[model samples]
Target: MKPASSSLFALAAAALHAALIALAINGLRAGQHNVPPRRPAQVQVQLLREQPKAAEKSPATPVQPEPLPQRPVHEHKPRTIPKPKPQPREQPAAPAKTPEAPAPTAQPSPDAAPAPARSNNTAPPAPAATAPAAPVKRGVFVDPTYLATETEKWYPRQAKRYGDQGTVLLHVTVSPAGRAEKVELKKGSGYPLLDTAAIDLAKSITYRPATLDGKPVSDSFNLPVTFQLHD
Candidate 1:
């Protein structure tokens, strides 16, 4: 009996140990099933990078200016004038006249009587008649001897040189005293020297007085003087 009993006891202990291990394995499988199921692990990814933003712009306004000043103006007027004067006129003149003449008178005859004088005494007196004169007597030479001698002496020497010969006639007046009062050349000799010599000779001659009614009186007569040239 004792051996049997010990062997049975050992066997029982070994079976109790196998039973505890099977219980621990079933507890681990149950805890695993109770835990939630795990979502697939999440992964985030970017294709482009992010860019910075730009600034905004506003509008502008316009300005204005001021004005200037001004000036003034003037005016004028007009004038006047005058006029002229007048003049005068003129006139004319006249004419003149003339006068007249007188008449003629008659002459008286010699046989008619003398007319009585008018008291007014306007006529002139008649002249008286006179007597006739006595005739003159011519004179003669008292002495003809002097005539011949004086002529030869008084002959001009110039007349003789030229062979000149001529006769000069003289008018002689005699006084009652038997003297020659005047001697005038009645005719001239062709030669002047002979004529001048004859005039001188006539002045020197003597005469017999003429008798008027038987009384000695003054008288005139012609006388001739001759000049001759000789060799």
Candidate 2:
């Protein structure tokens, strides 16, 4: 190669190296002067727990005054009653007098008679014999025959089927209408069925009412009912 060409090449390389060094220095200076972006400040938050509020009281209602009673209106004037006329005075009458009776006179006594001799003659008439009065019927008003018939008619069918036989005595109160008012067991039968049947029969019985001066009256009497089983 020629000396001039080499010198020119060397000068161009030196100029290129100097330009690179200057660019590197400029980049370093720009990095040193540039500042980083500022970070935002951190804020501290404190949460507070709120307490629940109490319920508010409602307002009270105002009291109303009661209405006054209305007075009666006086449209017309009151009526005035007139005084009565005076009555005339009457004179009293005189009383009449009663007459007196006359007095009775006194009588004189007679003289005694003489005794006479005994003699046989007609005998004095004998007093007529009087028949004895019939005995007055009293006390028990019911007839025995009628009571027997009623007791037989009211015989219980159950007692007959079971062949139960007994006699029950009952005290019964009879009303004025001859109807039995109350019946109490004076003597119960041996069997309960017989006793119950007898009581029912006695209650249903009607008797002849007792009489006071021929008028009917209530009376109590002992009644007997026979519950006998017969073929």
Candidate 3:
């Protein structure tokens, strides 16, 4: 048989132990349900660096052309040309020897053989003087207005830049049809450039046919092609 007091004490101790175990079990369960598993943190990064090989390139070789052939040297001597011979000059014949005034001498016996048959000397007739040279017809016969159509150079606009503009007086012979047949520059602008231009311009221009007796006749007309520089 156990004492009452002791039994009561023992029962109380057992009840305390049971209460502590139940509390520890409840705490374990709460911790297991509330906590999540731990995982490792991760991070990513990039690095930048230069690549030198990508920029490199090789050099190319240059091309050359073939050389030209050299010329051969010559040793032949140069030839000398001969000058033409001058002709000999002729001497003037002695002036016709006049008869020596019948050498005053004593003549007798058949009159000295009849005076040696007196020579009948005939003289050549005088040459007629050449008629005064017909005055060379001198003048121009081309219409300037029409001449402009033939040569644009006739315009002093181009010649004026070089101080070449002036009048060209000329002699012209026109056919019955007023066409310039013969044209000559009697007086020029002192410039061959202008003179040639006027001559060329006149050659192409035509004029109204001239009439002497109500009928068209080839006649000469003098005219001047004036070249002036003006705005």
Candidate number achieving the greatest TM-score relative to the actual structure: 2
RMSD of each: 48.7, 47.5, 49.2
Q: How do the predictions measure up, each by TM-score?
A: 0.38, 0.39, 0.35
Q: What is the per-residue lDDT of model 2 for residues 1-231, given as tens digits with 9 covering 90 to 100?
A: 556656666766776677667766776776798944333333333333344557777888889889899999979888888888888877667666667666666444466454576777969899999998765434446677877777778777777888878889989888888888988988988888778877887777667788766678788888878766666
TM-score, candidate 1, is 0.38
Give the CA lDDT, 0 to 100, for residue 218 in model 1. Answer: 85
Each prediction's number of clashing residue pairs: 0, 0, 6
Give the least accurate 10-residue stretch of model 2, judged by summed lDDT: 37-46
Best by the lDDT measure: 2
Q: List the residue pairs that clash in candidate 1.
A: none
lDDT of 3 by residue, 21-118 (tens): 77677777767998543332232223223334465566666677788898998899989889889888898888997777766776587745655665
Compute the lDDT for candidate 2: 0.74
Candidate 1 local lDDT, residue 226? 84
Model 1 alpha-carbon drift over 4 Å, by segment? 1-138
Off by over 4 Å in 2: 1-137
lDDT of 1 by residue, 26-145 (tens): 666667888543433333222232233354444444444454454454454544445445444444444454444545566777889997776976677777776777765555555667
lDDT for each candidate structure: 0.72, 0.74, 0.69
Which is superior by TM-score, 1 or 3?
Answer: 1
